[model samples]
Target: MIEWFTIVQVSVAVAAGLLCVVLGLAGRKPSDLTMGAAALVEVLLIAQLVIAIASPAFGNEPTGSLLEFYIYLVSAVLLPVAGGFWALIERSRWSTVVLGAVCLAVAVMVYRMNVIWFVQGA
Candidate 1:
């Protein structure tokens, strides 16, 4: 993984996590703005996956279990969507809580993924 890409992803994760937490704490119900932010983060994750996968073809392979990385990639991408769905169904401030939790989880997953990559790739 390129250094800059890793930084960008981590930054995104932090931003998304903080945003969700703030909204949740403010007792705001799920709003389009929150979902839209999640969607944007999801898009970045997808792009990251593509870059990570294709990098190997260009000879920048991560030494970690590509399988493990792929699994994290796929699962992390779904977290936001699942949270959003639950928020819509529950229709309460706690739904924002759920989204906040999801975002934080994704942040942790992103950091883990980066660790796995660097530990093995280095």
Candidate 2:
């Protein structure tokens, strides 16, 4: 839970979430731009996962239930892929809405993870 990384991750997640919601409200289906943005956010989540798990090697460990934190992190990582697949399958505005909601969920999960890391410090 590096400070700078967490800040960047939260900022990106929120931005991506807002973008997804906007795209959904605009009635756009899955498109290159939208999917790419989601993918970007997904990559960031995975990167955060890597850093979090490896932090202990660098003498940092989150002072929380590491397993539970991992569950949230993994879910955050999975959401974009799930939402993308669902959007592809449904191919409607509602599908985009689902993606938007997924992104928002990811944002919330990211925040929770931060709390878990900060409040329950290693």
Candidate 3:
């Protein structure tokens, strides 16, 4: 994955998480803005996945551990999508909590992705 893109994803996730926290604390449900940000993060993740697949920067063939890569790839994108949908349906402050939880998850996933890449390089 591109370093800049990873950095951007991390930044966005942190921002989204902070927004979610503030909204939740204020008793406001998650807004469209939060959902939009989550969607944008998913898009960035998809781009990162494409870069990983295309470059496989660790130098091993991309196909050898396809399943492992795919698990992270799929979940990283799917979690926010699911969270956003659930948030829309809930229509309560809990929705903001859900969004915050998703942001936390995305942050963890990004870190894990970096770790996997680093370990593979060793």
Q: For model 1, where is the 10-residue window of minimal lDDT?
A: 113-122
Better of 1 and 2 by lDDT: 2
- Candidate 3 has a TM-score of 0.83
Per-residue CA lDDT of model 1 for 1-122, tens digit only, reads 56677677777767876787798889888898777777777887888788887888898777688789888888998998898889889978788877877877887887778877777653
| lDDT (Cα) of model 3 | 0.76
Candidate 2 residue lDDT tens string, 1-122: 78778778778777777887788889888777777777888998988988997988998777788888899999889999999899889888777777777877887888888888778754
Clashes of each: 0, 2, 0
Ranking by lDDT: 2, 1, 3
Error of 2 at 13 (Å): 1.5
**How would you encode candidate 3's per-residue C-alpha lDDT over 72-114 as one tens digit per residue?**
8779889888888898888899888888878878877876676
RMSD of 1: 1.8
Q: In model 1, which runs have C-alpha deviations exceeding 4 angstroms?
A: none
The deviation in Å at residue 18 for candidate 2 is: 1.3
Report the lDDT of model 2 for residue 97.
Answer: 72
Number of the predicted model whose TM-score against the real structure is largest: 2
